[model samples]
Target: MKRIGAFLLTGAFLLMNVAVMAQCSLCTKTAQQLGEGPAKGLNNGILMLALTPLVIIGFLAFRWWKSNKEA
Candidate 1:
């Protein structure tokens, strides 16, 4: 039951679609001037930068959970 609930929650999170504006006012203006290609590049760059810390934290949390489960 617990495992099923966890899987369902994870599945729900994975299925969720959300748009994030990872741009500041200055960045938005810069992208607008630079055009679509640069705008996409800027957005991807920002997302990658933001994702690094999250990846690390998620990894740490998974490891902690696994260790606790073993105990």
Candidate 2:
């Protein structure tokens, strides 16, 4: 299970270079003005920010599940 999770994480990281257009209207307009490179950076920043919470929740859930399974 741990190995599978690690493999999936590695794959996701490797594939993360593909453009993510996850910007609000204002951010989208700002990124458009900033051009491609900056826009991509902005998108990646947003994506990471969004994923941080999900990753934390997933880790906590995994721990909880593991403890329950052990019990």
Candidate 3:
């Protein structure tokens, strides 16, 4: 039913968020291991900032498309 679909969607979103967090942690660890703590953090910050727009756009597009789809 609709409830099940909604639950699945929420779960999928949660899982995706967790995956991204895991990847971010891995990136941080790799940078630290390479002896570039400060540099790595800055690099990550810069990367995130640079990708912010793309992420936003993608999310917006996805939401727009999803909302328009018929059940």
TM-score, one value per model: 0.70, 0.70, 0.39
Local distance difference test, per candidate? 0.92, 0.92, 0.70
TM-score of 1: 0.70
Output the better candidate (2/3) by lDDT. 2
Which residues of candidate 3, in runs, are more than 4 Å off? 1-35
Residue 66 error, candidate 2, Å: 0.6
State which candidate, 1 or 3, has the greater lDDT: 1
Q: Best candidate per TM-score, number?
A: 1
Please, what are the lDDT tens digits per residue for candidate 1 over residues 1-71? 99999999989988988766799999999999999888989988999999999999999999999999999
lDDT of 3: 0.70
For candidate 1, what is the lDDT? 0.92
After superposing candidate 1 on the true structure, give the runs of residues whose Cα lies further than 4 Å from its correct spot.
Answer: 1-19
For model 2 the local lDDT of residue 47 reads 93
Task: Compute the lDDT of residue 19 as modeled in candidate 3.
Answer: 22
RMSD (Cα, Å) for all candidates, in order, is: 2.2, 3.1, 6.3
